[model samples]
Target: MKDSNFLKENNARHMWHPMAHPADSLANPPKIVVGGDGVSIRDIDGKEVLDAVGGLWNVNLGFSCEPIKQAIAAQLDALPYYSTFRGTSNDQVIELSWMLREFFEPDGLTRAFFTSGGSDSVETALRLARQYHKVRGESGRTKYLSLKKGYHGTHFGGASVNGNANFRTQYEPLLPGCFHIPAPYTYRNPFNETDPEKLAQLCATALEDEIAFQGAGTIAAFIMEPVLGAGGVIPPHASFMPMVREICDRNGILLIADEVITAFGRTGDWSGSRHWGVKPDMMSTAKAITNGYFPFGAVMLNDKIADVFEQDTSGRGAIGHGYTYSGHPVGAAAAIACLKETQRLDVAANAGARGAELFAGLNGLAEKHDLIGDVRGGHGLMCALELVSDRAAKTPIDKATIGKIYEATYEAGVMVRVSGPNIIMSPPLILTVEDVQKIVDALDAGFSAA
Candidate 1:
């Protein structure tokens, strides 16, 4: 079985790759990553590469964290599988919920609904939003508002609400009534405004105007990523998030902060809401929650929604949504340990300090490289380098050029993600300033190749 072609043949015969054409996947045979320790991943060929994107931007504590592994193992030994359905709950689940509530601080959030991953978490949020509206006798409030270029998850509902066309092109005729408006992206400002605060106001005004045109009564919720992770890592415009909160309140609409990517210190804060001073009515979180140690996601509900269940409108009307893996004991244990390790290690602060260094490095690169059209990402550990065809015109580099740069970067031994012509970076929070310099150096080399 040591043959180089053995696993490739076996995989081609049996396994189907996600998000790829069959012919292309076979031709580019997937690199089998054998192991991960700290911020480094070892491929089957035994070559070591740094995990710049934290293994899909979920491994907040980096790879091979012993405490998380130990916690999962101990939970497996004690009670590997259990459900949080009906009235039954496990210690890990209960403790994790309380810990989350405490961490979030004196918010009105009263319950935590668990799911398998980010997509399911979005599904859960959509269902719960519908239920909450129904309980309040506002059943017609079925429409949702999300941001253009925003990515929630890949589920039917999530994808429908998400505004990225590339992800939803194949699945046309998605769920109806999901509308989109421009998010607070300063880099590609539609209004061409220089002031970040002014740009945010303009965007927020657009949202309010859209709500009015759509009739706020028909809209149940407005969802957005506080940091806009997938849409080229666009952080909110200055003081823009708080304005959204005000708009939602004025219109009696639920603000759902899809922190699935921004939660658990990705933004150098407990939640992106805290970073932006936006208190969302409902918050969906996952990814870094367990540091990718186990599959888990959660939606925290506010007291206003919780009150509906207390009135006893039906037979056991307790939110009335769940998944088979909801509140899995092992997942809960992993979350508990992961959260503990995050706090003990001060991961948020690490992200904050490291983010400053990363931003400076990228900014310097932007100044040096004409192909680098723009760079963005605030006080969080998120950054994106937009490649361009012309420096003075700020024109985006062509698709073919972007692909060439991406391939060149990969060949240069750095794994960076390409979203359109933008090379996005959300490296592991544990990265030191020196590690960030290395990533910048790799990007520089990739640029030179272009």
Candidate 2:
């Protein structure tokens, strides 16, 4: 291997990372991951740590999934590239589509549209939602509503509907007709209600109010994450999604479930919509679809929406949107192998079991650490710890303090994500009980150092 310092210098000089300032890279060099095995990753400096972030909440099966790797290699050798744009389609995508139909049947989704990644999936769903309305003669329904703090993706459509200002302020004058409502976040909410069920009701009512204000006929869809992932793993109350579904049904607004992070057994269910027993009109899925092995995604359409396009005699249904690498054969093959392995291993059961332990461990840590203001996680492998300088006032911890905790956690042999004041954990579903314990121990040490 090349010298770690040399690699770091080159990376600092030449590479610009996502979600970071270019100048910050040179000041604080990012860890250069040399290799990964199972749920652990090794840096170029030879420090191995348990990966609690799970490759940005996608790698459910861990790093060394050989079946998917072999499938990609085989497909590359056979048919490396193909576009499913018009008449031409690859056999692998067709097979994967069939599998997706079977998998998403519980969520009432029957048709699949291929994309290159999560942003593509969200954008596809957003466009298709509007198109569905237009095909049904509801051309005025072009507006969108989403929850505050709910993250869809970075695309224009997704960003317009996204609730976070940090992502939107820099890119001004995004698409109009997009609005946001209060999220049912228990730790902090506009309603100031601590009860999850009551907050869900309040948020649902807010959604209803927003729909009424926007006019039912003018609204295209209500897009949201089942359990808010990037906005800090804020799982809504049990009654939340079902209430939204009822409201959307009454308003003639399509429900778009952004399951990019919560799909493929991340939330201890096949899909987050199914977890709440709420069937959305369209579902945006990616990330875990290929276990982070390939950049691929799919937007699933319910029968009602699919039938509209299928029966439309006009060319309006003809898709004008698609990526050059959409339905790439290698990605499709990797997804196929990933789906097979995901089911064979039954990672959902393990996620649920391990998630319980992790949640409990985090809560225990909260008891010991004054900096931990709130602990959130129970559904699956995803969890978060909100740090506070003053627990009584819920004042967010300073960046310098957060950096200290993060460095300590890294030194203690675990790699968790720090999103603002939140310490996020989404370890591979293949994690054992001992692995969970090790993560807890590492966090314990980190909190002690802080």
Candidate 3:
């Protein structure tokens, strides 16, 4: 490794980070992570801390997931690269599809469309949703509906469906016909509803209103995260998703569960849709699919989608979209190994247990510090603390204030992600009880310093 100053100079000179200003690189150089093991990571300066961000909400199995690492190396040695395109499918992908079908059998997902990552998965699902409608002779159903504060991805389709303006404003003139409804965010809402269940009902009604206003016949699908992730880890009421499912069913609109952050047991269940007891027409999964060992994703489809495409005599059913690395053998091998390890460890159970403890700790911190305006968690390892300048007015905390808390937290011995005014934590599911307490203590320290 190069010296700190050398590495820093080169990074600032060459690197352009995503979701950040290029100029910010020179002023506020990003932390250089040089090593990771177990659930901890060490920066270039050799400052080690418990990782609560979980590698961008992936890496559920932590850094020492040997099975996935070994599988990737073995597959690279056997077949470095093979594209599953145009009548040529790799053995690893084929086996992985079968495993995925069985694993998601409960969610009614019978088919798998592989992608390179979360963005690819979201793009694939959006395209498939429109195609599914077209296959059934409803090509007019091209519009998509989503929840406010929802995040899909960066692709045209995903970006259009994204409800957050941060990802959309700069990239204007995105794909047309994408609509959004109010999310069930109980903390602050236009409806001013504080009760979660009531807010969910109101939000569901907003969906119905949007369907009515847009004419459901023209809407192709509704995409949403079971627990809104990047827009902030906002978990809706227990009744929210099921209500959305029923509404979509009635409107004949496909529901695409964007499980990019909630799949493979991050939400205290095998999948978020399962946690809600509602099966979506299609599900976009990635991140933990390979435990972040490899860039991989899979969009799982139910029989309703599969039957339409399979039964179509016309070539309209033919998928017009795919990635060159759609079914890369290396990615497939890693996913297979990850699935085995994820199931063996039963990560959902650990996520549930640790998640509860973490949520409680955050709430306790809220009591101690006025900085924490809202504490959101409960489903699993995904959690967040929405900070504020004024608790009474709910004024968003300034950037420097949140940055202070972020730096203090890191200094106190935990690395968390700060987005806008929210401190998000999607730690590895393998977190120990002691690790959970440490995270809490670190945050306490962060707040005290702030």
**TM-score between model 2 and native:** 0.99
Score each candidate by Cα lDDT: 0.84, 0.93, 0.94
The residue ranges of model 2 lying beyond 4 angstroms of the native Cα positions read 1-3
Residues 11-118, candidate 2: write the lDDT tens digits: 877878888888987888888899999999999878999999999999999999999999999999999998887889999999999999999898898999999999
Each candidate's TM vs. the true structure? 0.95, 0.99, 0.99
- Rank list by lDDT: 3, 2, 1
Candidate 3: C-alpha lDDT: 0.94
What value does the lDDT take at residue 146 in candidate 2?
A: 96
Candidate 3 lDDT by residue in tens digits, 308-348: 99999999998888998999999999999999999999999
For model 1, residues 185-211, the per-residue Cα lDDT tens digits are 776867888678888888899999999
Cα-based RMSD of candidate 2: 0.9
Weakest 10 consecutive residues, lDDT, candidate 2?
A: 4-13
Q: State the TM-score for model 3.
A: 0.99
